[model samples]
Structure formats: structure tokens, C-alpha cells
Target chain A: MQAWDISFSKLKAGYGSHVVLTDVTAALPAGAVSVILGGSGCGKSTLLRQIIGLSKPLSGEVRVAGRDICTLPPAEFRRVRRRMGVLFQDGALLGALTLAQNVALPLTEHLNLPAEAVRAEAVRILGMVGLSDFADFYPNELSGGMRKRAGLARAIIAQPRILLCDEPTSGLDPITAARMDDLLLSMHRRFPEMTIVSVSHDLASLNRIADYVLVLRDGACVFAGTQDALRASDDPYLVRFLNRDGAGDDAAAGECAAPAVQASLDRWFAS
Target chain B: MPQRNADDISRASPPVKVLRLLGRPALRALNAMGSVTLFMLDGLRHIFTTRRILGRTVRQIYVIGYQSLFVILLIGLFCGMVLGLQGYYTLVRFGSVGMLGSAVSLTMIRELGPVLTAIMLTGRAGSSMTAEIGVMRITDQIDALDVMDINSVAYLVSPRIVAALLSFPMLTAIFDVTGIFGGYLTGVCMLDINEGAYLYRIVSSVTMTDVAGGFLKALVFGLLVTTVCCHQGYKAHLRRDSVGPEAVGSATTSAVVISCVLILAADYVLTSILL
Candidate 1:
């Protein structure tokens, strides 16, 4: 597997007319962990989707390695896409398949491996994710964290050079989230040249695993640089985000409350 | 304040407003038809191009064909028995009770066999296809496939469509046979309409053209139903009627309704052509 640098040159993306990411321009480094930082609905997932070629950008270019994927023909783009893996939120493992079967999908679909070889590879990946015991369990039977691990196993089974994770630690307990972060780090160690890009708001995980950071806010890329640069910056929005400020929350809380709602709450809880 | 009607809303004349109302749905229906056709073509293309499709296709056949056998048998038997009873009585009225076999066999072979089989499968397998694909769409499994550089349509839909193609005619034949037997139970066993007369008329009245037409209808109905159901599920995310989990339910409902309607409509057209 060869790590591929992903560069977005003035990329704009969204569904139909509702633009979620506007004029975004940044390059995620090859052979390193780059964390995309943003609040919910701040175009983090949209950017990840654009990079993964799940949806084409409305305008501009997304270059993988050196080729602009947006301009590539469908057949050509599919070849480029084969070098990548994506871990979606909620795991997104197929409910019909067992954990090992889900993990084996990429290999079985893309390669000419025999059944035993594919199973062996799947088991190895599952073991990496610490899900060897639950190989036969359906996705629905597993907990959310376990499913996420299985999703990670499936994503990396083919040893893709470019790995994109969408909020990988979003809904996990502290211990599980930490384990997931460590697992991602270990993956980077195993595949030293693999480029790992994660979309997340987890400051802790970002601090631990991120070699580079790209922060998005209000449909724009606010910052694209090293984590140290992001930390040392004095920008107000960046400062607020980095410090986990509650000022915006207070303002939103003010607008969200009403006297009618307060009165209803009082009446309801009066008993 | 008074309640406003369509005339008050946009200041358009009644005729223009009516035309506007009708045009919107008419255009939407046309767009849906075009989309379903394109989806079928795409799925059909993948049937030839996808590697290792046989295993998936066989699995789908088991689900869509083998699993539906009992229901098809049950429905076919009842349909046949009802036809025999009704045909027997109707012929008895004209002192032509011997025509019961021709009536039951011809009816099953020409029309009811293919149409009922498709409708039954639409309810049984078609709805499941829609719901399953719809869920996949909502849950990002389809996108997962896309990210994996695997053709989601090839993986999810092409197999089902191929399975339906192979399954529909076979099931229709079964339905026809079961229905004729059902007719025998009612006409020959119950009414004592002369068993040989019943079987002999069935063989005499059913021509090769009739059987071919029935099979052709079966194939077309299978394609239409499977394609429509899969399309609804595949594009569940784009549905304007709902979003997220609700979209899956809406897509499934729309798939089954649209499939059933298409089956009946296609049956009419095919029957007209075959006749």
C-alpha cells in the first residue's frame, strides 16, 4: 500500500443547492494522521465525503496523490477509490453479515483471494481491532463501540493507503474512545506509509493522534496547519474552540428558552 | 378571516390552477418512469459485468423464489379452485359444464397465473428488497460500498433482478399447475365433472403460444417489480417525501405500491399485445 496525499483546491460541496462546504482549500499530508476539527454540521463530514468520492464536489478539485479525482472518469476514479477506505459514523456495517463477513467484503469483492485466505485476512484484521471473539456476531448484536471497531476492521482489511474516518470516537465511552484512538495509532504504526484522515471534534483524541490539524467552521476552512501551529495561534474562533468556551452555548440557551416553556415546565413538575 | 382555496393562493384562474395541479404530478410520474427504466438498465448492465455474481444471484433466488413457493402454491390452489367452482356453475347454467377445464386452464395459463404470481412476489420479495436496500441507503452501507470502490447496484440489486428473472416464469408455471389442480379439486372431485374431461380439455385448450405469452408476462412483470423496488430503495436518500429512518419506510411503501400498480398495468398491456 502506498500513502497518497489528498489536496483540495477550492472545493465546494453539498446536496443540491444547500452548500455545506464552500471554497474549501487544504491538503492532508501523506503518511501521517490529519485530524479535521469542527463542530457538528460544520462540513467536516461533507469534506470527508468529497475526499472519499462518495459525492462529487459541486466545484473545484480534489486531488488524490497527483490526479484530480473530480475530473477523472467514473472508471478511472473507481481505481483511485480502491486505494482508499472510509469508516462511517455508526459503523455502517451491513446488518445481514456477521462481523467477519463484513470485514471480508472488501477483500472478497476486490481481490482474487480464495475463501480460506479471505477469512484468514479478515480474522487478522478483526484481531487488530480486538474483535476476534465476536467474529460471527451480527452487527446488531454488538454494542456501538464494538460495531465501530468492526467497522475499522472492515475499512482497513484491504490495507488501503488512504484511510478516512468520520467521527470515529464520537459515541463511545472514554475507555473505548481511548482504545479506538490507540487502535488508529497502532494502524499507522503497522502501515507506516498509510495516510489517516479523521473528522472529529474530540479534542482529547486530536491531541493524542493528530500530527496535522484542519479546522472547519461556518462552511470554510479556518485553519490548515500542524497541531502545534493551531495550538499556538491567537485567532479568537480557534481560541474559543481550542479552549472549549461556553459563551456561545449561553447565547444559544437564551434564544432556546421561552416564558411559555418555563411556565409549562413549572406546571408539569409542580406535582 | 375566511379559509382560502387554491384560487386565492396564487391568483390564478381555476383552469390554470387545475392544470398546474395535474401537470406537477403528471411530470413527476413521467420522471419516476424514466428513473425506474434507467435503474433497470444500469442493474442489467451490472448483471453481465460483476464478477462472482452467481453466488449472490443464487442466494437471492432462494429468498425470492424458493421461499415464496408455499405462498404461491396456497394462492394458486385457492385461485384455481375458485375458478373451477365459478366456471363449473357458470357453464352449468348453459348446460356446458364440460367447458370448466378449458375455462380454468386457459384463464390460469393466459392471465391469472403470471399476474397473480408477480403480485404475490411483489408483496413477498419485492417489499423486502425495497426495505433492505432502503435501510442500507439510510445507514450508509451503500456509501460504504461506494467508498470501497464496489458497485453498490451490482452488489445489492443486480443479483435480485437476475434472480427474479429466473424465478418469475418458474413460479408462474407452478402457480398455473397448482391452480389447475385446485380447479380439479373443485370441479372434478366436488362437482363430479368427469376427471378425464377436465384434464383433456386443459391439454387441448392450452397452446404453446398461450404458455409463451404467459411466461413473457411473468418475465416482464418480474423485471418491472424488482427494478422498481430496488430503485426506490437505492435512491431512498433522494426521496422528497421523507428523510432518515422515515425515508426507508416511505421508500418501502412506495416500492410495493408502485410495483403492484406497474404489475397490473404491464399485465394489461402484455395481455393486449399477446391477444
Candidate 2:
């Protein structure tokens, strides 16, 4: 199935008028894990939001599963969304619910599973994510890694075909980040047809997990190709970003300036 | 090659700049009005899903509404005593203790019960709703729900509005009953008013219209508190400003203020029309 071929053409998204994404055009191959590599304010999350249909694009088309999701009617849009899963940064677990309850939410809301069946499924997913022992715990009771594990369990509960993760490794220690990478890769390996896209500024995590990569800078796609191609290119941006060096030529130093901002207006307005 | 041409850039007046800064969000909010109305309409549509939503709503009423009954009763009794004490003194001076029972029952049932109970909810439930949804916004749970193809407003706001509409009137009824009983207790136990006559006057004087008006006001008040709180919470900035916890505090405070304004305004209009 060509269900995983996702493309965005000149997509623009903003919170109100302060546009976070400006004319971003990119594509990711079917059933491949694509990491959106970027600095803060580079519209990585905004791109994810547009693809997920949370925020409407100002101008452009996002073709996911070969349909224009932005213009789809409500019922159609919901059908599109049902095929997706999202692991929000900060682990987005409901504080009011237990970890099992959080994981069971999608099953309860979208599936025909009986309550007992949902409970059993929730336990299975939590066990898959290494959070089985923590099922009865509330979000406040779990550690950061455990919360992320519970969040992962929730995202995959409905076994969506497309998974979008935002900053999955942030606020995590290196060991935990590596563990999360293993978990993500294992998930991909288990369902080879799953299209997984993750947003990350962490080069190490991206390098560890991303098969196909798109480097976004200032709300536009700078590069979209394989991780090996990105590494081999003489693009100083890829170098500095990968090198984690603060000292570099201005353009390549992972700087984030909102798109279409002129030099004069940029300095003048920030004053 | 060029000196900074600060003079080249013209600035709008301060108020104009502030207005411009606010304009986008204001327009966005205006655009979202359709969504809000649709959400409210969806709550009304729950007349079909009553088996599900009402069961959920009634369960919520048990947890959120009736669980607070003790405090409501306490406030009602105290409110009645104060009204009674004031009415007794005022009526005694006019030698119109006969009118005291009528006055207390009518005001308590038609006005104070709904108003006071709503004010209490503004403190109790309104602030809580703001906190709950605000935390959800900051934590990105709201976004997760959106990505899951659920209308966050319908999922979050509709249930709340339904619960409030159902629960607030029930609470007001209890408040009205306890408040009148409190007045009776004061009149019969503490004062020299004939117990049977006082009870009779309270029962006879309060028209069905008065009680119905109070319940109607309760419904409106409930909608106001839930809608305003949910709105404020929905708009809670993901980034809490350097002004500290001011945003959450302000959301809660705004819920209370907006609820109070809507209730009083609705009270005036409803009383004018219905009474």
C-alpha cells in the first residue's frame, strides 16, 4: 500500500499572525521513519500540526495517504486522523487518569472493544512500552521516562498506521533517549508498514533513529533525503548541526529566524 | 555603508500598537465563535445521546454537584439567617412581621439561591475547570485529543456545560429548600412569630413562578460558569508568562468575573421577563 507517502507543498501555518511555518514544502516516503531536524522555532511542531490537521494551512496542500487533509470535510478529516497516532512532547498523559486509563482512552473512544477487552489491551500495550508495572499509577506518580512510556503506549493503543512524535527525546537523559530510540525502532520493526515521523532538535537521537531525514530551518525544508546523504553532503548546516558546535559561519550555525523577515525590519522590530 | 535609519520606521500610537498586537488573537477568537456555537449545539444534540452523555453528566453531577452539597447547605442556612435577621428588624419597625416570611422565602427562592450557589460554584468548580483545562493546554493533551480526531471542545466543553446545566438547578433547589427551612427555624425557634403561621405564609407566598424563575436562573448561571471557565481555560497560553502564575490565576479570576457578570445580567433580564 502507498498509504505512507506524505507530502506538503508550500504549507503555511501560524498561531494567529505570528507565522511559525512559512511556505514549507517537503515529502516523506511511504513506510519510512522521517525525522524533522531543526532548531527551536524552526516550525517542526507546526509542520506536524498541519499534517495532523490541528491547525489549517494558510496556503498549500498536505497529501497524506494521497488525500488533501486540509480541505477534507469533518467526517473525512476524522477518518484521516483515525489512521494516525501522536506522541506529544512532555508525554501528554492525562493527569486525571491512571496510566492504564490513559492508554485505554483511544481504545475506548474509537474502538468497539469492551471495557474488559480495552483493559487487557491497555495492559498489553503498556507492557510493550515497558510500563506494565506502572499501569495503576497516575501521571503525577510516574517518573519522566515512565510517563513517556505511558504516552507511547497511549499513542499506539489503536495501532495507527502513521505515528507522529514531537521532541520525543527532550527533557530526557542520554540513556533514556537511547532507550526511547530503541523502543521507536522496535515499534517500526514490528510494523514495517508504519509511517513514523518524529520532530527533534537532538542530533544524537535523530542520528540514532532516523532513516530518512528532513532538516528544517526557519520554517522551510533545507534538506530532505536519507540520513547517509545528509551526513555525506558538504552542507555546512548539516555539519554544524551534527557537530554541535556554537562557532560556525552564521547561516550554518543552527540559527532560527522566522521566514521572510528583512534585515532592517528584523532588527528594528525586535527593538 | 548605512547608519541605522530609526527615523525611516514610523510607529503607530501606543494604544494602536497594543490593539494591533491584540487584533489577530481577537479575530481568531471571533472566528472560533462558530466552533463554540457548534459545540454548544452539539451539547444540545446530546438529547439523543442522553443515554451516554446524561449518564456521564449525572455521574459528574454526583461527583462535582452533589458532593458539594454540605457546603451549599451551610452557606444557604447562614444566608437565610442574615436575611431573616435583617427582615425581622426591618419588618418589626413597620409592624409587618407578617410580610417577613413572604419576603425571605421569595428572595431566597427566586434570587439568592441561584445567585449564591452559582457564586459558590465560581469559586469551587469554575476555578477548578480553568485549572484542569489550562493544565491540559500547557501539557499538550488538548493537541493529542485533536490529533485523535476528537473535537476537544465537544469532548471537554459539552460535557461540562451539560453537567453544569443539570447540576446547578439541582443545587439551587437544595439551596432554596435549606435556606427557607433556615428562615423557619430562626422564626419559630429564636423569634416569637407563630410557627404554624410563619410556615403557612412561606408556603403560600412563594408562587410557583418564583421557584421556576430561580431554576431558570440556575440553568443560565450554570451555562455561564461552565462556558466562561472552559473558554478561558481553552485560551490559556501554553507559555506561562514571566509574570509568574498570573495567567492561571487570571483565568480563574476571569471565570469568576465573567460568570458573575453573565449571571447578574441574566438574572435581571429573566426576572424582568418571567416575573
Candidate 3:
């Protein structure tokens, strides 16, 4: 099977007065995973939004499967959305809905399956995510890692050709994150034709899966290269970030990270 | 407590006191009117911004409106029966049971139908929309829609607005019809009047103007119900301040209160002009 690809051309986007992505031009190979890494509020999610058509670029276009998604009508756009799947940063599993219902939402909205078939498909996907026994359970009933897995389950329930994930492993423990990484990799290997694009601060996870890494800082890419190239680069940010033991870096200065990063690396940006 | 200075001792005259007393209702009216205006403007903005989402919206309206009819009609039937029984006893004291038909038809068709129906819809459908949209808004499902290149407003608000526009009127008509029947049963079966007279008075005594008046009032009330509920939902979507429950209560209450006030107000104004 051939690979899927996503490309953005001269894209500009913002929420009202704040321009988040400024003339972003990038490409993600079909059948390959690309990791867009950046600090929180540095417009990484905004760039992801531009690619998915959630956030419109103030200029230029986003092309997926050779069509400019920016120019498609809303219906056509939603039809385009059927070709891709997204796991939200917060999981967004619709807490009130059961795990089965949450996973089956896209199917119910888009497919022609019978009720039993939809239920079976939901169960099958939930089983793949290791939530087979919890089909009747709501999102609030699950743990964080389970919620992320359930989100991934829902994203792939329709068997989309492209996957967009935001912080797939942010809240999980190291072991759980690795488990999720393995799960994603196995899925990637199985659906090798699907393009997987994820925005994450988890450098370790990125190193495991990312074929191409784009480093974002202050709303722009500071580096765009192969993961091996990024790891070998002498840039203090790359070295310090990849080491995982480094005291600080501007990108890792956000919430829930090490306190050492805040004290030492922030001064570098201030200078 | 006893040390009253000139500023503390300042007192208004009886006439001035009466003026303040008279101004309270006006002030309340202004506030309610202001909220309604703001809500309507916001609803119109959402409607226009997502024109292509109308097909789904219309389907939603059809489902909400038709599915809700039985409940609305059930409530309307009881309401009409109670009104008929009460009106009959009240008219009997003056031997004015003949006037009972006019009273029930006029009241039910011109006022209670729209008001009660709007209130009922607010409780059933309006609250659901607010809760659903509120959750979606906070959890960034709306943002998800945006990323999928879909307009959240079109996907969410338009169906609800269309539901209100179509639902309330159908329910109000049911109320009007049931309430008249309730009156008929009381006047003909219980009171032993000519069945023809009871039906004639109901069908004839209610002028084209009265039916028209009911429809006009219902149409506007439908807009108000949709507007208030959708605004509360949208606001609940944008702000995660636990205002959803409070807004739901306020939206339902305000929908009933405003629809009644406007229906009565419009009735008076419209009656004066048309009659």
C-alpha cells in the first residue's frame, strides 16, 4: 500500500488579534509519522489545527491526499475529516457517553452499519485499546492512560487513513507512555499507509516514533530535520532536551515538568 | 444609631416615593427586554455564519418538534380541563355560563397555549441543548469541530434554533385545540347545553383575529425560547464557570416569563389596533 501525506503551504492562522502560525509551510510523508515539537502556547497545536482544518490559516492552504482542504466547503470539509482521525489533548471522550457510544459516534454519524454491527465494531476497537470489558463504562470511570487509549480507539474506529494526535502520552507514567508509544507504533506498522502526525512535548516518545521532527519555538520552527540529525545536533536545546536529565530548556519550561528547567533555561531565553 | 446627620436624615416626599414605586416595573421590563435583544442578535449571528449546516438543523427540528408533541398535548389537555372546570364554576355564580366558551377559547387560544408550550419545551429540549453544548464547549469538542474544518455554530446552534421555531407552534396549536375540547366537554356534557351551541361558540366566537393572534405570539415566543436557550448554551460553552446549571434554570424561567409577558403585551397592543 502507498503512504498518505499532509502538506501546508504558506499558512497563516490566529485567534482574532493573535497570530499563532505565521506562514507555516511543511510536509508529512505518507506511511510515516512526523512529530511537531514545541513549548506550550508556542503555536504547535495551532499548526496542528491548521493541518486538520480546525483552525483556518489567515493565508495559504492545507492539502491532504492532493486536495486543498482550506478551499473545500464545510460539508466537503467534514467529508475530508472522515479520512483522518484525531485524539484530542485532553482525550475528550465525552464523559457522559459510554466507552462504546463514544467510539461509535463517528460510525453512527457517517456509516451505514446495523446497530449490532456498530456495537460489535465498537467492542472490537475497545478491545484493541484494552478496554473491551469497559464498553459500558463512561470516560470518568477510566484512568488517564485508559482514557488516552480509549481516545485512540475512537480515533481509529472508522479506520481513518491519517491520524492527528495531541499530547498522546502527556499524563501517563513513563511505563504507560512507552506502552502507548508501542501501541501507536504497532498501529502505525499495521496501517503503514496511514500518516500519523502528533504534537507532543514527550521527547522520548518522539524519538521512538517520529521519522521527521520539527522543533517549534516562539511560534516558529527552530529546526526541521530527521530525528537522528536532531539528536546529534550540538544545539544546547536539542542536547539538553534529548538528555532527559538536563536542568532546563525554554521549550520544557511549561507546567508539570521539572522545576530545574524553570530556573536555569528561562534565563537563557531572557538573555 | 441615633446620630442622624443631614445626609442621613434626607427624606423624599410622598409623590417622589410614589414615582420610585412606579419605576420598578419599568426597570424590570427594560432589563428583560435588553437580555432578549442581546440573545436574538447572537442567535442570528450563529445562523448566518453557518448557512450550509441547515439540512442537519432542519432534521433536528423535525425530530425535536414531532417527538415532543405527545408530551405537550398531554400537558395541554390537563391544563384545558382544569381551566374549563374552574371557569365553569366562576361563570355559574353570575349565571354567565354562556360567556364561558368565549372565556376559555379566548384565554387558551390567545395566551396560555403559547406560554405553556414555550415553558414546557424549555424544560424538556432547551435544557438538553444547553447541557450538551456546554459540555462540548468546555471539553474542546467545539474546537475539534473547528479543526475538522466544520463550523461548530452550524453543527450545534442551528438545529436547536430550527427546533424551537418549528416545535413551539405545533405544541401551542395542540394546546389551543385540546383546551377548546376541554371547554366543550364541560359546557355540553356537564352543563347540558346544546352541543352545537358549544362547538359553534368555540369555532365562531374565536375570530380569525384570535387564531392569528395566537400564531403571531407563538412565532415570536418560539424565537425567544430558541434565542434564550441557545445564548445560554453558547455562553455556557465559552465560559466554564459552572454557570450551566444556573443558566439552564434561568433560560427555562426566562423563556416562560418572557414569552408570557410579551404574549400579553402583544395581545393588548394587537387587540387595540385590530379590534
Candidate 4:
């Protein structure tokens, strides 16, 4: 398996004039787990959306496996997407399909495998996520944490070169969150060549899994470095965030500051 | 002072307030219409562009057509029975009870069959389609499809549109046939009307042109219902305030209401052209 790197070059993206991110230039190194961190509305998910080509940046480019996906035509873009997998925040599994069927979807859609083979492959992936027994269950039947794991199974079932996860542990108990982080790490070790980019506000999970960290503030990349570098940084925002400070004594003030404060507070309570 | 008072007066005027109140919904409705048209066009384009959707389209036909068969038949039978009873009483007053067969058959073939079938579909299949897709939208399942490199509109929408288009005429024909039979049972057997005259009048009065017109109306109504429902569902997530069950409910209600209105309006226009 070969590794694929995702690079954003001056990416600008948003919804119809309300720019969520601007000039976000960064790279997730090949085969590494890169975690994007931000307060609410800081454009972490926007960056993820751009990287996956779900929505094109207003300008600039997103390069995956050295191809600029922003410029690819629809068919070519789909080909590019086939090499990537995304796990949405709420699983986003098809409610009508059982868990196994949901996991088998990409295989059935993209490959001409026999029905038995697709089912076998789906079951294999479900085992990996520890949901082998729940393969027949619907997404609605699963617990929130189980849904996330099932979503991960679906994401990696196609053996994607890159995996994108949006808030993989946003709504979970501490134990479940830790389990999710462990699962992510184990998956990374199992598929050493698959680059994983996760958008999350979970500090503990980030510390546990992130090899590289990118922090956004006010739609701009305020920090991008290794986890060690982030830990050592004296940047007030980073320090305040890492320390779980709700007071803005060292943080910036005004409109952007309030949301950041509220975000940190929300995370504090969430954790 | 005078200018400011005049501005206030104009702003508070009854006509201006009425215009303001009406303008918002008018604009919203126009925007909705534009969105639905574009969605329908996109689905139509995909109908030609994609060939692998046959399986999904067939499944949709099962859900939209086969599942709704019983309700459509029941509605058709009741409608026909009512028409027969009413026509018998009205025509008997003028000693023209024999024309009851012509009236029932013609009504079933030309007007009631397509219109009533569509109304039933709007309440049944159309609302369900809207709610299903709306739930998908709210749950981010559609976005999940997008990330999976699937064209959400083509994959989720085109099949329903195609299924409805193919199924509506079939359902309408079923409705008309059942309705005519129901009329016969009421008029000939129950009311003791002449059986020979009843069957003969139906055969003579109903023409291919009337049948074709009914089918044409069903086709248009099917397009309108499916397009409106799917469009409503697809756009539910775009609304700023709607979420979860509210979004699905709103989409379903709006799909049924808007499609019903459009069906009736289109019926008038199509009837004028065909008749």
C-alpha cells in the first residue's frame, strides 16, 4: 500500500459570501494521523469538506495523492473520491439498509463482486470494528459510539488510501471516546499507508491519536505542527485551550473572542 | 417633520402592510417553484445520462406503484359507486336514467380517474417520498452520498421521478377500469337499470381520445408530484431553522399541498388543450 498526502494551497471556502475559511495552506503528511482542531465555527469541517471535494474551495486548490481535486471534472473527481473514505459525525449510514449492507454499499456500487463476496467483505470489516454481531442491525438500533465505529467500518471497508472523519467522538461517554480513539489508532497501525484526517474538538482524543495538529482560529490556520510542538507552544489561545481555561484573561477580546470562549466552555462541559 | 410623518404614514398604511405581508410568501413561492423546476430538469437530464439506475428505478416502482395499488383501487371503486348513484337519481328525473352509464364511464375516463388517482398518490407516495428524502437530508445521509462520490440527486431522486412517470398512467387506467365496474354494479344490479343499456352506453360513449387525455393528465400529475416532493426533501436542509422531524414534516406537508395545487392547475390547462 502506498501513502497519500492531502495538501491545501491557499484554500478559501464558505457558503455564498460568508467565508468560513480563508487562505488555509497546510498538509497532512502521508500515512500520518492529522487532527484538525478548532473552536466552533472555526472552519475545521469546512477544511475537511474542501479536502474531500464535497464542496470546492471558493479559490485555491486541494491536492490529494498529488492531484488537484478542485480542478477535476465530476467523473474524474469521483475516481479521486473512490480512493478516499469519509466518516460523518452522526455515522450518516443509510437508515433503510442494515449495518452490513451499509458497509457493503461502496463495494457493490464500485466493484462487480458477487453478492456473497460483498457480504463476506462487509462482515470482515464489521469484525474489525467489533460490530460483527450487529451486522444485521440498523443504524438507528446502534448506540452512538457503536454507530461511529460502524461508520468507521464503512469508511475503511473499501481500503481507501485516505480516510476523513468528522467529529468521530463528539457525542460519547469518556470510555466510548477512549475506545473510539483506540480504534482509530489501531486502524492506523493496521493500514499504515492510509492517511487519516480527523476533525474534532476532543483534546484527549487528539493527544492520544494525533501525530500532527492543525488549529484554526477565526477561519485561519493559527497553528500547524507536531503534537509535541503544539504542547510546547506558548500561544495564548493554544495554552488557554490546552489548559481548559474558560476565562479570556490571556485570550483575544471582541466578537471572535466570545465564540472562542463559548467553544472552549462547551468543550470543557462536553469532556 | 412633514416628510418624516408622511414616510411613517406610508409605511403603516393598510395597503402597504398587506403588500408587504403578501410579498414574502409570494417571493418564497416563486423561489420554491424555481428550485423545483431546476431539480426536475436535473432529474430528467440524469434519466438520459445514467443507465445503471434501472434496478433502483424498478425498486421504486414497486414501492410507488405496487404498494399503492390497493388504495387506488378502493378510491376508484367508491368514486364510481357515488357517481353511479348520483347520476341515476339526476337522470331519472328527466327520464334519461339510461345516460347514467355514459356519464359514469366518461367521468371515470376523462376527469375523475386521473385527477382522483393523482390526489391519492400525492397523499400517499408523494408525501412518503418527501419525508424519506427529508429524513436523509436531516440525517446528513445525502451529504454522506456526496462524499461517497455518488450524485445524490441522480441516485436518490431520478428513480422516484421515473417510477412515478411510468406508474401514474398504469394506476390511472386501473382506477378507471375499477370505477366503471363499480358504476355498473350500482346502476345495473342495485338500481335495476337495464344492464344492456348500461354496458352499451359505456362502450359507445368512451373514446380513445378520452382515455389518452386521462393518461396524459396522469403523466403530468405524476411528474408534478414527484418533482415537488423530491425537491422539497432535497431543499429541506437548506432552510435555516428546520431540523430533525420538523424538517421532514414540513417537507412532506409542503410537497402534498404544492403538488396537489399544481396538479389541479395543470389539469385545467391540460384539459383545455386536450378537450
Best by TM-score: 1
Q: Comparing 1 and 2 by DockQ, which wins?
A: 1
Candidate 3 CAPRI category: incorrect
Q: What is the lDDT of residue B86 in candidate 1?
A: 90
Clash totals for all candidate models: 0, 0, 6, 0
| lDDT value, residue A206 of candidate 2 | 83
**How much is B105 displaced in model 2, in angstroms?**
0.9
TM-score, each model? 0.94, 0.87, 0.68, 0.88
Candidate 1 ranges with C-alpha deviation above 4 Å: A251-271, B1-26
* Candidate achieving the largest DockQ: 1
Poorest lDDT segment (10 consecutive residues) of candidate 4 chain B? B1-10
True contacts kept of each: 0.87, 0.80, 0.37, 0.73
TM-score of chain B of 1: 0.94
Candidate 1 per-residue lDDT, tens place, B1-275, comes to 22355446368877988887788789998998898888899999999999989999999999999999999999999999999999988999999898899999999999999999999999999989999999999999999988887899999999998999999999999999999999999999999999999989988888999999999999999999999899999999998879998999998899889888888888889888889
What DockQ class does candidate 1 belong to? medium
Runs off by more than 4 Å, candidate 3: A65-67, A72-79, A243-271, B1-101, B143-204, B207-220, B231-275
lDDT string for model 4 (B111-224, tens) is 999999999999989999998999898888998887776678888899998999999999999999999999998999899999999999998998899988999999999999
Worst lDDT 10-window in candidate 1 chain B:
B1-10
lDDT (10s digit) by residue, model 3, range A128-151:
888899999988888999998988
What lDDT does each candidate get? 0.92, 0.82, 0.75, 0.90
Q: Which CAPRI quality tier does the interface of model 4 achieve?
A: medium
